[model samples]
Target: MARQKDAFYFDGFRRSADYACQAAKLLSEVMHDFNPDQLRERMDGMHALEKAADGVRHAMMDELVTAFITPFDREDIDELGRVLDDVTDSIEGVLNRMYYDNVTDM
Candidate 1:
């Protein structure tokens, strides 16, 4: 049971981090393609990836709460989870701003 719980926590963290990295890569590609123009379409994909990351984060939290012992400090785990989520949220916000301002061009 303990090993399974540890695996779940680690897996969730890995998945979340992977999503963030992938989203950043996608956003970078969008920026490259759009150049100075706002990245509207690129944002759609970014948002999707962000949501995926959030899902993993929520799963981790849920598991954490149910487990009697965590491999790391609960606060640390929560903070790391939030930071990963923040990366996606921040990207989404940038996309939102570009879309609302009608500055998006490619």
Candidate 2:
């Protein structure tokens, strides 16, 4: 049981990292190819990635509440997840600012 719970946490951590990577790539693509016509669509895509990352973090929190065998302390695991989520948010934030501010250049 403990081992299984640990596996869940590990899987959650991995997924979070994957989301961060995807967010970074998306942000890069949007910035590299700035297009006013596609700004809305790009923002939508970034929002989706951010939302998905949030879900992963939320799941980690839910599991942490009941997890007895986390890789480290429960608070540490929770903080790690939050930090990972923040990374996605920070990446997404750039695109969001561009979209909202009507950035027309790199």
Task: Tell me the deviation in Å of residue 90 in model 1.
Answer: 1.0
Which parts of model 2 have CA positions greater than 4 angstroms off? none
Please list all clashing residue pairs in model 2, or write none if there are none.
none
lDDT on C-alpha atoms for all candidate structures: 0.78, 0.86
lDDT of residue 5 for candidate 1:
67
Residues 14-77, model 1: lDDT tens digits: 8887887887777667666764443555777788888888889989888878878888899998
* Cα-based lDDT at residue 106, candidate 1: 62
lDDT per residue for candidate 2 within 12-86, as digits (tens), equals: 889999999999998888778878899889889889999999998998898888765667888789888989999
Among the numbered candidates, top TM-score falls to 2
What value of lDDT does candidate 1 attain over all alpha carbons? 0.78
Q: What's the residue-level lDDT of 40 in candidate 2? A: 89
